[model samples]
Target: MTTLQGSAVFSACAQHRHRLDRWWSDEPRALVCAANPSRTDALRPDPTMCRLAALVRHRPGLGGFVLVNVEDRIATDPADLRRWLETADPAAVEVARRDNLARIRALAATAPLRIVAWGTLVPPGPHRDRVIAALSADGRHDLFAFGLTEAGVPVHPLARGPSRVPLGAPLVLWRAADEPS
Candidate 1:
């Protein structure tokens, strides 16, 4: 078994520190949650980040928000991503889920809102189930919202063009039943 320190996952999380660190200083008004890293090794300010930032900028009333992932590890190969999401070891998934939750809670302590933008990419399992439960139980339902795609799944910023986003509108959280249990 590979330790997290020696795994590619750790490297990915470490690389993203710069962007994540900014959240501490800037103190975002919202907290955005996405699925996980795809081909990219680090969670830098990519197009999705840019779009989310734009939302905060153009809509100053919405305030600024930090973006994060439900899973912090990197999925270098698309095929491997599917394997991990669908059938990875339960222990590993639990660890990732726990880390993600901790980060979310810590960040949420300061942020006023939480945004769910994982889209259809987030695989269904106990991990996701627990996350939803935590968010729902956190007593911040008013802060939770989703950015819907054309297909009606929660969407990542880059998934759709900026103009398409209902920027001024309040986002409705996706139904729990819509996701696989």
Candidate 2:
């Protein structure tokens, strides 16, 4: 994954949008679901995306890791993000959640690599769990994550250095039905 260039495909709402999608070429698109959107968009990318881009350069197949989020709202500040998630208008939140999931599904249709890396930002469940369930749905289940964060979710891209090995391995969450409860 060393400097594989491709077109940038960004699907986002207007200025005050709920979510955004920043994707690159189509060598092997991997679906990456994070806690929420930072200040990154098509025009400008934040440090998290920067770190992810560098990390992917070392690994081959993880090219064009498309980023989604457990929460759709964009918030650079953790406190503000949490508040929005908890206090935002229900109708708006629902709309954003649905839009995000639809984009994830559309991307997952072609992407072989799907990862769940929301960290502890998603209240340990709900939004995170919802996204996982959605990814596991439609009978096409395949998910992965780099490493475990302190919150026990997948390790965030920002937390890793290029020295790390392959992107991530398959997760049991992908095989939800096969596992016994």
Write down the lDDT of every candidate, Cα atoms only. Answer: 0.55, 0.60
Lowest-sum lDDT 10-residue window in model 2: 172-181
Name every residue pair that clashes in candidate 1: 29-64
lDDT of 2 by residue, 68-129 (tens): 77766667777887687679888987887887777667766776666666655666446555
Q: C-alpha displacement of 13 in model 1, angstroms? A: 7.5
Please identify model 1 stretches exceeding 4 Å from their true place.
1-28, 38-44, 61-63, 76-79, 85-89, 137-140, 150-152, 161-163, 166-170, 173-181
> Positional deviation of 142 in candidate 1, in angstroms?
2.8
Top model by TM-score, which number?
2
lDDT of 2 at 7: 33
Task: Compose the digit string of candidate 1's lDDT tens values, residues 70-179.
Answer: 67655534466667667978887677667677767767666556677776777677777666644444554443444676676666666657425655565666644234
